[model samples]
Structures are given as C-alpha cells and as structure tokens.
Target: MKLSKYLGYIFLLLATLAACKKDNGNYDYKELPDFYIDTVGVQKTFETPQSIGTVVITPKVVYNGSESNLEYLWRVYGTTADTLSREKEFRSVIANNPGTYTAELQVKEKTTGIRALMRYTIIVNSPRPYGWLVAYETQAGGSTDVALIRSTEIVKTITTDVVMRNIYSEVNGGPLAGTPVSIVSNVSSPAADMLFTSQTAVRLNRPDYKKLQDFNQLFVAGAPTPKPEAVMEVPFFGNHLINDGEVYWQYSGLFIGKISVDTKGYKAAPFGYAIYGKNGGFYDMLNRRFIYMEQQLSQAATYASPKAGSTARFNLGNIGKDLVYVGIGFGQNGVSSNPDTYKYAFFEDIDKSKRWFYGINFTLPDQPDLCMVDISAMPNIFNAKYFELGTLGSVAFYANDQILYNFTYNNATNTASTPSVAFTAPAGEVITSIKLLKQPGSGYTGTESKSNRIMYVATWNAATKNGKVYLLDANPTSGSLMATPLKVYDGFGKIKEMCLKPA
Candidate 1:
C-alpha cells in the first residue's frame, strides 16, 4: 500500500510540472490611467471670518483618464464629519464654531474603484475677536454668567457697541456655580482666563473661553476646601492664587505649589500685584503689614528696617491701616530707568475714617523711595465702593453709589488733587464695578492709546432687575471721562467683575 501511495504522489508532481511547462510568457497587460491633483494655485489653508459667512475653494485636477468617470466630494471634520459639497469645486458656508478644523477633498473613479484624498486646514475666527468680559450674577437664581462687549474691528476708538450676553453659558452649556467673584485674563504667552465664583474657580482657554482647569485641578494635590479668594497673573512673572488665606504659585500652567509660610492667623488681602523681575507685594490683613516674596523663591519674607538717614515715607512692616484696594496706577513719564513706575495701595484707618494712598516702586521693595499721601480729604473717599488705577499718569478712578470720581496725585509734592465727577448713572441704578480697558503690552501706540483711555463702568438697577455697561472715553492726560458714554449696553445681570480680553 505504501509503494502505491508514493507512486501516486510522484504522478501528481509530474502532472503539475507538465502544466507549468505548457504555460507561455506572453500575456495581455494594461496600465491604469495616470492621475493627480494639481496643487498649484490651491489655497491649502483657509482663514474664514465668521462675518464673511462663506468660503470658496477650487482645486485643479490633472488626469489622463476621462473626467466624466471621476466623482468628487468635500467634507469638514471637527467633532464629527459633515458633508460640504458633491462637486469638483467647494463653495459653501462654514458654520463651525471659532476654532481650528480639518477639511478633506475626495475623488473616486467609478470604473476602477480607486480613491484619492487631499486634506486642508481651516481656521474659523470669530467676528468679535476680543472685548471686555463682564461676569455677572442673575437676580433670580444667583447663578453667574459672562458677557462680551467687542467691536467689529480693531479701531482706534470703539464707536459702536456689540455685546454678546450669556457667553459663558453659550460655550459651557451651563452657568458657573455660585455667585461671580472675579474674571481675569493672563495676557502672557499661553494666555488664559481665570474665572472665580464663590464656590469654585476655573481656568479657561483664551479666545474660545473653554474650561481648561477646574478648582480641584488647579492645585497639585486637590485643594482642601473650595475657598478661592483671588487669582492673579503677572505678565512674565508667574500666576498666584489665594485660597483660604494661603497663597499658591505656578509658573505658566504648571502644578500649583503653596508658598512656604505659616499662614495660621494671618490672611492675605484679596488683591495684590506681582511685578516682573521683582519681589511680589502682598498685605496681611491680620498683621496689617506689607509682605514681600522674592522671584521664584519658596519662602516669603518681610522687608528690612529702613537705613538710618533714609527718607522713608512709611514703614513696610508696620502699616497699621486696613487695605482698601491695590492696583497698578501710573508710570514715570517715559523714564526707562524707573523700574517701579507706579503701584498704589489704598488704605484706611481701622475705623474706616481716614484713607491714605501709598505709592511705591515695585522693583525696589526694600528701598525708601516711597510716597505716601493722605487722601482722606478727597471727596467721597470713605464712601467709595470700587476703585481702578489709571495707566497714563498719577490718576485713579473711584466709584461710590451711582457716581464715579477721578483724582490725580502728585508724587513730587505728596498731594492729591481734588476729586472730579467723571460719571453719574441714572436714578435707580447703583454702580457695581469699574475697570479700565488697559490692553496688556509695552508702550502706548495705535489701539493701545485708545484702549488705555477707555473705562468700563457697570451698573445694576434693582427695580428693573437689569444691568448695564457704559463705555466711556477718558482724557489721555488728565484722566477725565467724556461727558457722555461712547456706548451703553443693557440687559445684563448684576455685574460683579470686568476684565479685558485681548485679541
């Protein structure tokens, strides 16, 4: 049986060899038609302004095959893919939100079933590129939302008002928790917007305002409690947050670390300024004194005693007054040598009877070159509810009830000019917030001149349960506001905080 099987296998192999020998080398051969997409004069990347409403793209094709056998399709890819066109050329309205997206052009040959694909980058820019961000609280539910007041273009002066309300909910799908506390933006590289509510704090992406980091995520190892007080970004220095009176520091967007200090009985003031390449200035409410933290230093220290014969205006470690407000005021008259141009800290007596303004060079915290002027005599200084500093000169704006006042200080003579009425709201309205439209950058030119001269005043009417924002053009030199507002936008909730959103 084994011999019979082996003979059968040999016969099968011989049959296969004979079949291969009978086959010939000559055979019918054909090549598919050569084709390619001509990229010359094609716009591979498109930046479509939302106001334009349409984008048109025409791609040239080079092919040796019949054009009638090819089918073309176009689509945009974002969170999902959506068909755009079924023709060779793409002409349609791009309704995607303001963001970066991808688009694809597909060509298919019906006969050969061959497909070719080409991709492009698309950028959709919002018409309201940048503006004033107003965070408000609803009167009914006490929920917080934000509004944007922007211009159609970057003009020297904003003549017309374009307001988008409830923008926080529009992008986030819901209102921020708790009541509004503050809204601030970091204009440095990798810009971001930090929004704080009574219950939590959230860091949002610039331009789009999408939530990036929540309250818990802001800390290296989650926060012990949701007691966010304030978050501040100092241009090129760093970012600081005060939670439960403890200060947290982070450079750029890295993990937050607590400053090395025993913050047991002392609580930090809600507002402070961190200057670039200088020690940060913070106030301790419990000790009622000024504290300094060196650049990139983990520990915060107190300033040394003034040297003998030094003309010290006030002792840094012994400021007994309560802090009223702290903000950047003015700068030296184009003097490049002055490191600390002007940072003002307003203080009042323990009984809130008298007010004083302290001007110091943030760069030289230990120096005696400080100016302290008694501003208690300024009209309505004790009654002021909100304050904002001017960027041009030794000027500041303060609001009390429904009235706004502007006053200038003389660092040379240590005197404060009489307060002038900058603006007054209509009856039944109370001023809630005041902020200067100061764009972040060096030098005052072009739009900076106009932005530095503008002021935003927000008011709320209890009877109508509505809020209004007034855009006022200020005097570039004297800081006096225009007699009438450039524009007024109404129908907002109770405004709590306002900040500039740069383009």
Candidate 2:
C-alpha cells in the first residue's frame, strides 16, 4: 500500500512539473519593440542641382523609447561622397557636384544598442541658371581673337595667339576657328541645350560651352558637310527643324535626325522664314523667290497672296549676311493672329547705309507675306554700325562711332518713329559694340523690360589705348535717353564686342 502511494505522488509531481514547463515556455515569448524610420522608401528620391545647392533631409523617426538616447548620422556618396551631417534633423547638406548620389541615415539607440538604416537616392543636374557666358573680341597685332566672359566676370580667351587667356573658362573642346559672327541659342528645348556660332558654324553645349561634336557630326549619315555659315532652329507645325545655310537637318532628340536641302539662306527667322540676299533683293528660301513661306513642314515652298505692302521682293543691294545683327522682337501690340503683327526683323545692307525692316504676316495662309519697310530715312541713323534691339519690342538702339540713337517702332500705326538721339559717348572714345542685357543668363529672353535695363557700351580711347565698359541706365521710359552711366568698368584690355551670359 505504501509503495503504491509513493508511485502516485511521483506521477502527480511529474505532471505538475510538465504543466509548469509549458506555462514558462508560453510566457517566454514577448512582442518585439517597434522602432523604424517612418518615411516610406518612395520618398528617397532627390533632384540634383546645378551648383552647390543645399539639400535638407528630414526623415521621420519612429522610436519606442527615449529620443535623447538616439544618435543620428547621415552619409552621402557618389557625385560628392562624404559624411553629410550627424544631427537628428538632417538639414543644410551641400550637394555640390553633378551626378548620382546615394545617401544613408543611421539611427542608433545608445542604451539599447539598436541601430536602423535608411537609404535614399540623389540626382544632381546642371540645368539653367547655368551662369553667363560673355562673348567678346580682342584685337592685338592685327589679329582679332574671341574670348568668353565667365559668370564671375572673369575673361577667358580661347585663342592661343591672343595676349590674354581666360584662365577660369571651362570650355575644353577647342578654340573657335575664326571671329564669331553671332552666337545663337536653341530655345525650343532645354534637353538640347545648345548654342551655335557663325564662325565655322560650331555648336556648343550650354552647360559648359564645350563643343558638342565635330562640325560634320551634325550631318546626316555621316556625310561630309560644307562649313556652315549660320545654323538656326525653326519651330513650325509643332516640330523643330534645323537649318544650316542651304541644308536642312531635322532634330529627333539627340543623336538622330534627317539631313536634306529645304531652303537656301544664311539667316532665318524663328517663324519659319528663310532670308537670303540675292540679286539686290531679299530671296525667300521657301518660295524660291522674294516671297514668304506659306506651307508648314512641306518641302514644296509656296508664296502668299500678293498684297501691295506684303511682298518679299526688295531692291536693297548686298544686305548684311551676318544674321548676328538681326533683331526679332514683338510689336507694340500683342501677338497678332496676323503672324506678322508683332513680328519684325531688322537688317542692314552691306553695300549701303540703309536699313530694311521685314514685316511678317500670316493672317491668310494664302497671303503669307514678308513686307519690306524702309527705315533708312531716319535722321542721324548709323547705316552699318553697331545696332541692337532692346529687350522691349519696337525699340532699337544704334551706335554710330560715338553716338547712340533710339529707333522706336509704332505697332499701332505700323510705322517706325524718326530716330532720336539717345546718348553721345564720351568725346574721343569710340563705341566698339552696343548690347542690351535683358535677362540674368545667356540667350535672349526677348523680354528685357526691366527698368534696370543697362546698356553696356564698349568704348576705346584712341589717345590712351585703353578700353572701358559703361553701364548706362537704359530705361527709355525714364525720360533721359542719354542719362549718365550707372557704372563704368575700366582696366580690362580693349573690348571689341560684349555678350552677356546670365549669372
């Protein structure tokens, strides 16, 4: 009886021990403490900047314990690799370079020794506000050289034979072949941010002002091309086509396009008109005569209805082939449905001291026209001297040796007012070039209506052999057309031409 009672007690004790073990195993499992970065992975992308721009990274931190015990660290790599910062709130990180970058934030709890990491993607871009590219010319020992003005106002010369060098310039493609007749920008798209120069017809990237490719690279099927006298882009029928003199190169993004002959001209208007000086008159390339372009994107050139005032035929002789001086601006009235309403292109004859204005009209497709208006009758007008169109439409400023005249156009009456004296440069100082800086960056914005419009006049003192640049207040509405200069920059070498690249 005693042995049986002992066995029962042992069984009861063993069963009790098994139940306790099961209870302990169930109680041992506890929920994990939640701590993570609250930001979703989708929020990891960042835009790159052109310069050393600041990037603020504020990641949401989800912690279960005391926040003071947590340490934060941010690391950035790729374009500019480095430890960005250590503060819990990431801010003021400098993204100074252009490229892809990877950023990681490490959050560590001191007491618990718990660490969490979050990664992000960064993309840096060198877009607009890319700074100014100043195009200027220098002459020494009978050699005219071209130079680029950096956004820092630092003069950089590409020509090796020149006396000075543009020490700060970043253009590494090579020097320009000859004197630049004009620098034209590709305005239709920023993806193809490019500029074309008249001399050698070289194409340059806007980002670094470097040569985009070889001159022949722009040709179709790698065919040989003649040295382009001028290159331009014309937007019509919702598409852009490239024109370099007589040849036509269509733009299909970056490395693809069709090359063929469509029009013949050294200059073209933005509104699809090819202008060439031939037989003592303006030859319209599209119409194969002195006429306007009627069809859009069609190889067959057509003429507009022959209105008395709307014919491309002109008797002007040997017009300036340098489209660099051509000015396209708006009329006093807004963009007219006439297509010719506010559109005017001013040109000067190479053989004579005469100015001809070509008025564009597209009211009637059948009546598409380029009307020639003679502006040579204006008094004291400089025939072939430095003439510049102001940012504001209908106003043109001319420089004749030492005099500056303003020629205002009246869109309401379709007439150009008589030329008035705007300013007389200092005595004994010859005006080299007249340029109006309307915007902050390179390329024309066509809206230089800022009251602070400054007319940069490059002057050379023959007596001193010194060059000076005068910044005159160019507010025509200010009543004083010949007001004193707001600032004069002296001490640089002789400046023959001035072009502004925005800063």
Candidate 3:
C-alpha cells in the first residue's frame, strides 16, 4: 500500500512538470530578422555632360547584406510627390529641370523581417555642363601629299542652350585654312554630351594622301585644294566624325531633296548619300539609272525621303565598269539603261560645310569662324519650303530646270504664319481637292491639302543593287513622315551609312 501511494505521487508530480513545460514552449514575444533600407551609397549615372536638351538621370541603388536582384519601389518628391509617382522612376529624367527634388527607393527582401530602404537627395540645383569637341590633326608628307587639309575640333562658349549633333569644323591659327575637318564622338562621355562643342578656330593641318589615296578611286570632293595647315571652318559647332564605315551628308548648295550634281546641276534622287559594300552595285530604283550603287542591310534596298526640296548629285564618269558611285539620302539610287556620260559633278564635302541654310547657318552665333558659306543673302529661310506648297495649305510651283538658283523675295511670298507678312487663311470651309487648285508641271508635285498636318515621320531606308532610295508617306498630298529605309539589292556593292530629309 505504501509503495503504491508513493508511485501515484511520483506520477502526479511528473504530469505537473509536463504541463509547465508546454506553457513555456508557446511564443509570447516574437523575435524578427534584421530589416533596413538596403542601399548605402548613391550613384549619379550622368557624367561629363556638355550641353542640355534632354538628359536622363538613372539613379543606382547600392545595397548591403545578403539581398540580391531586389525589385525596387521608387518615389519622387518635390513641389509634388503623391501625384508624381504616376510617372516618376527611380531612374528618371533629371538634371534637366532646374529645380529641387528627392528620391526614395525600397527594395523588398526575399523573406519577411528583412527589408531594405535607400533614400537619396537628388538636388538638381542647377545643370552640370561639360564639353566634348576636341582638336584633331593629321600629317602627310614626302612627294606631293595631301596634308591635314581639314579638321573638325570641339568648341565651347558660355551659353545656356546646348547643341547636340555631329559637328565638323576648320582650324584657325593652326596650319591649313581651306582644308576640311571632322570631329567624332564614340560612346564616350562628355564628348558625346550635347553641351560640349568645339570652337578653337578650326586649324587645318595636312591631309593624308594615304587616307585620300587609300580610297582615292572611291571619293572625289569638290573644293579648292589648300596646303596643309591651311584650314577652312565648317559648322559652327564642328563636324561629327563618322564611324569606320559611314557616309555623312547634308544639304548645302541645292534644294532639300536635291543635291548639287555639279556646281550648277541638280537632280532629285530617292535619297542623298550612300555606302558601298564588298562586291558590287545597287539597283537604282528612284531615277531608274543603271550604275554601281550602295547597299543597306545585306539584301534590302530602295527608299525615298524627300522634304520640300531636298536634292542629290552624281558623277557618271568617276565610277568604272567594275565599280560605281551612288548618291544617297532619301533611300535609293538608280541608273538608266541609256548610255550617259556625266563626266564630272559637284558634291558637298562633308568635312567643310554645315548647311547653306538653317538656324545656325547665318551666324555661328557663338562660333563666328566656324560659320561660312554666305547664307546671309537669304535670312530666316530654312531652304525647304522655298519650292513647296506654303504652310498656308496650297502647292507652290516647283521649277523643273533650275534648283537653288537664286534667293528672290518675289519667288516665294510670305504667308499668314509670319503675321508680319500680310496674308490670311480662309476662316471656314475646308478645300476638298488641293490638286485641282494647284497648277502643276514637273520638278515636284503634291496630292494633299492645307489641313494635312504631319502625324508621324519615317524613312524607307532600303538598300539596293544600284544604290538606295527613300520613300516617305504614300499620300504625297501633304508630305508624309514614314521614313522607313528598305534595301533593294542586285550584286556585290558597298554602302557605309545613310540618313533622310523628312518633310
């Protein structure tokens, strides 16, 4: 009886201990893993900016701890924050608006209790500007050589507006005066930025006969020969350097869609300039001429980009039976079956001029020396609408025989847009057919009316066997903006690069 009673007591005590143990096992206060704003450092993506047009600032979030590949939640705050989230990005357009702003980033952790938050004070108090245009010189000597006849260097002036584009310029106080020049911007920074442009008085050095000779048969520039160190100034901002296999072209001596063939000759090809390829020719589709041409993508060709009056020129004599020279810009070039001899033609040298017309053409406002080409004769004229239907909504007769002949006020009368120039738009009643009202002849024609505002612009950059051609919108009434480039090909041809003159 005594042993049984002791055993019962022992069991009761054991049961009591078990109950206490279970109560302690349950969690009362929870313990959590560490959480924090993962980012520690702020990174500014933009560096060495030369000018300002549109600058995108992508802020980087530096994280700490074990978190990787975290998705970030971004927030922007300034005069407005709650509403701005709709468009603001952690990586957003910055340094453009001259105002104060802050950014917040939160990167979620893989598991609960581990969170990261990064805060950045991006005070774009002012715009940071830098430059890229630099000086380039070449040397050629020994037995009749072409020295650095031209060079395109970088220029800088104290200004608020930033200009961005490939610039070509001449050297002042260096060597050559009438020489061509070029400045190139790779993916490198500051130099590639819009703010930095060269203007150290373009100084021409000497041209490399080797470079000129290396591809001697391929190119012929229309300009007076100048001794090395004798430079000719070009674009106010300087000329842009072309990549290894590229061709640069702009309108100068002729119409928008027309390039001067000879000093006085002009014709409208599908495009403006072209590039040649490994083996052969381009099928000229625009002019329908038969000659060696430039190609685009491996097999695609044929396109046309014609603004109001863009033009391109060609030389029939320079290209040999085995080789060919093609004009490009719009998109394609063609040769005719009929035998023809265009022994010599005038083409604008890419290294020497900016444009005969444009905003900066008249005055290199900041860079005087770089501005040349007496565009003073006609001020404020973009040279495009001269031969086209006025912006008022009707077609202007285009002269077939002569293009870029002379600047005469009587030629193109001012319309209502200028307001200062006396004219009026019919208040109501839209005209149905502009073609019927337009007395058309040849050089150029349109099928649209005044209400045709351009919605989109595109280039038909196609590569062909003879060359290339460009085609814009199909309507042609009010010019279209479809400038997609297509390539029309035949055999082995060469083409480097190309662009378009959109309406």
Candidate 4:
C-alpha cells in the first residue's frame, strides 16, 4: 500500500507538468502593429508655403500592446541648419529663396523603443525680377562684349559681364563671322527666350548662356545657302533681319522661324537703306519700292513699286531712293482720344537740286504725293550731314562737321521756320551719330523717364584720334538745344551704337 501511494503522487506531478506545457504551447493568434508611408515613389512640387508631405501609418491598429504610446516627427534641413521640425503627419515647409533641401520623417513605438524613418529631397526656385543689358564693341579688335546693368539706386551701372568669352564657342564652335551688331533679350520669355547676338545670330539660354542653336541651322536645316553675314534687331519694332550682303531677310520674332520678308537680292551698301514704319511697311532704297507687311510673311502678293503699271498711286518719275535721307518728323494727334496718333515723315532728296520734304503724309492715301519745302530759309542747309527729329513734332536738328542747325516745321501750312545753329562742335571734329534718347519703352526698367528728355551725340576728332560722347538736354531755354554738354563720356575708341536697357 505504501509503494502504490508513492507512484500515485509521482503520476499526479507528471500530469500537472504536461498540462502546463500544452497550455503554453497553444496560444491564441494575434498580430503586432506595422507601419508604412503612402508617399513612396511619388514626386511633389511646392510653389508656395504648404505641406510638403503627409506621413501615413499602414495596418493601423488601435492603441494597444507596446504600440499604445507612439510618436511621430518630421524635419527639414538646408545647407547650414535644420530649417523645420514637426511632431505630426502633415509636415509643411516654405523656401523664399531658390535651392535644394532635405526632409526626414520618423515614427516610434515608445513602449517597445522601436522606430521607423524615411528621407526625401526637395528643390526651391525664386522668380527673377527686372534688369538691363548693354553691348560694347572694342576698337582694338572690334570684339563685342555685353554687360548686365542693375540699379538699386537712381543711378544705373554695369553689374557684370553676362556673356563673357563663351559667345564664340556657342555658335557652331567657330570664329565670329562679323562684328557684333546688337544683343537683344526676349521679354516674353526671360528664362527660355534666347539671347540674340549679332555675331552669327546665335541664340543662347538666359541662365548659363549655353548655346541653344543658330538661326542658320534652324532655318535652312543644313542647306547649301550661305549663312547670314550679320543679324541685327531693328529699333522699336523688335524685328530681326539677316543680311547676306545682298538682300535683307527679316523675321516676325525670334520665336517664329518663318521668313517674314525677303527683298530682291542686289549688291549695295553693307546694310541697305530701308526706312521701316510702325506698321510692317518699309521703303527700299535700291529698288525704289515700298513693301507693306500686313502680317508675318505677308509681303508676297502686294507691294508698292515705282515701276510702271503698279497698283500704288505714288510714283518716283526720275528720283532715286539711294539719294534720299529719311527721318520721323513728328507724331500728331488724331480724332481719337489717343494722343499722337498721326505720324508725319521727313526726307531730303539729293538730286541734281537738293530738295527737302516736310509735313508729308506718307501714310494717308489722299495725300501720298511728296511736296518740296523751301528749306532755302536755312542758311546752312547745304552742309547738313545727319539729322534727328525732336519728340516735339514741329522741331528737328541737323548736324554737319562743325555745327548743328535747328529747324522748326509748321504742320498747318506745310512750311518750315528759318534754320539756326543749335550747336557747334569743337575744331576739327564732326558728329558721328545723333540720337534723341526718349524713355526706352520696350523692355527697359530704368529711372530715366521720357519726361526727362536727353540727347546723346557721339563725335569723332580725326586729327586728335579721340572719340567722345556728349550728353545734352533735348529742350533748353538758354540759347541752343545743345549749347553746352551736360556730361561727356570719353575713353572709347568709337561709340558705334548706344542702347538703353532697364534696371
């Protein structure tokens, strides 16, 4: 009986151990919490201050187990420091300047001390405001250089060389075909609009000035035709012309590749004498013809020619177009509310007997005929070499080697006042170019207003071998318009061209 009771106790102990082990081995099925972000494999943009990303938890479970206490954090960094930090899913950021940035997101299970993290990259950009650009040609090698001019104050100044020595390599990786004529910026597209250079008419990008392409390759497409000798932007019209030493091919704008106007090719001056009007109409000197541009590439069917049996009413019987001098005489008021709606033209015909035409209505069909003015009233009419029309339609100034003449026009009666000497150059000097500096309206953002009229005259003294630019008041009361120069800019070999850019 004692032996049986010992075995029974041992059996009881063994049964209790087996029951405990089987109970622990078969536990109920339950899953732990997991996390993931939905923003993976996607790109985003932030133009303004807004949430850059929203972190989401995947297979989200109710607060229980170790995940009962959780934490979320987001951070952003720039080059120098941590820019932003947040404790929630929606992480927001703002960058006023342009650059690259980094962002990070982290989530942690506080009880278990386990964490999950993610990283991202971002980019920011700022808008480019307004500025001006100037072009200079050195007399040493006739090399053209461009300067960017910016002004925080009232005075304008050159800030940097926008296009350095890279202009040569930008165009076909070859040498410049000719002297640089001009540099023009497309206002419509500040970033993509190509910077136009006269040297080979190569278009360059705005930021790095990388070569985009040339007009020759884009237009001709590897054809056998000779590339343009030079490309120049016409003042006020924003139109560009390609000269092949014979004819001038013009385009509506650089954006459009179509050839807007193709004149009859002929040998003449380097750039032929063509007076372009506000409307796409031009007077050709060589052919003695007038081509009116109704729109882009619209010069094919109808044109004004002096040849017999033409549709145009006006005819040049024996006069030649080359021996003529043209200038915008005045802008007059029309019947409409807009001021200065009517434009009058002035041209001097250099025939056997020199004659001046003033107050001529070149745009009106009824008054298309040219009438000679009795400029004999002016004593120095015989020596006027270059001329400039004043903004005030009735007045104009003419210049010779030594003196400038001021002539007044009477639009009502179609006559002119007696010409008087307005300015006298120094001994052995002559005026090379005379430009009336009106406020540059097209793309200039400078302090110089149209109200503050100014005149820039470039003079060359052959004997002294020096070139000087004289700044004068357009309208003065003391004696003459250019009685004394307000300022003089020297040290230039020759002031070939002067263009105004805004700052």
Best by the lDDT measure: 1
For model 4, residues 1-503, the per-residue Cα lDDT tens digits are 99999999999999988877745556676565565544644443333312222323232223444544777665666655463554544444443244656666666777556666666665544222233333334444345444332332213343431222223233224433444454545544122233333445555544333356665643433322433432333344444343443333344344233333454522222232223353233444455544343434433222433444534334432224342344444454323222323333334454525546444334553444433465644666656666666654456677777777777666556667777776677887677666665444323354444322556676767666565666666662111465777666554434344444421
| lDDT by residue for model 3 (226-340), tens | 2211111112212221111121221221001111122322222222221223112222322332222222112322222223343312223221111111211111011211122
Stronger candidate by lDDT (1 vs 2) = 1
Q: What's model 2's TM-score?
A: 0.54
- Tens digit per residue, CA lDDT, model 2, 276-336: 2110112333322332322222233333335466433432222222222444444334432
Q: Kindly indicate the candidate among 1 and 2 with the higher TM-score.
A: 1
Worst 10 residues of 3 by lDDT: 145-154
In candidate 3, which residue ranges exceed 4 Å CA deviation?
1-17, 22-291, 294-503
Quote the positional error of residue 400 for candidate 3 in Å. Answer: 24
For each candidate in the order shown, give its overall lDDT on alpha carbons: 0.76, 0.50, 0.24, 0.47
Of the candidates numbered 1 and 3, which has the greater TM-score value?
1
Compute the lDDT of residue 442 as modeled in candidate 3.
18
Across 432-502, the per-residue lDDT of candidate 1 in tens digits comes to: 99987766322346545565578888999999999998888887557799988878889999998998777
Candidate 1: global Cα-lDDT? 0.76
Q: Compare the candidates by TM-score and give the number of the best one.
A: 1
In candidate 4, which residue ranges exceed 4 Å CA deviation?
1-137, 146-199, 202-238, 242-252, 255-279, 298-323, 327-329, 333-352, 358-362, 369-385, 440-448, 461-466, 476-482
Model 1: which residue pairs collide?
A: none
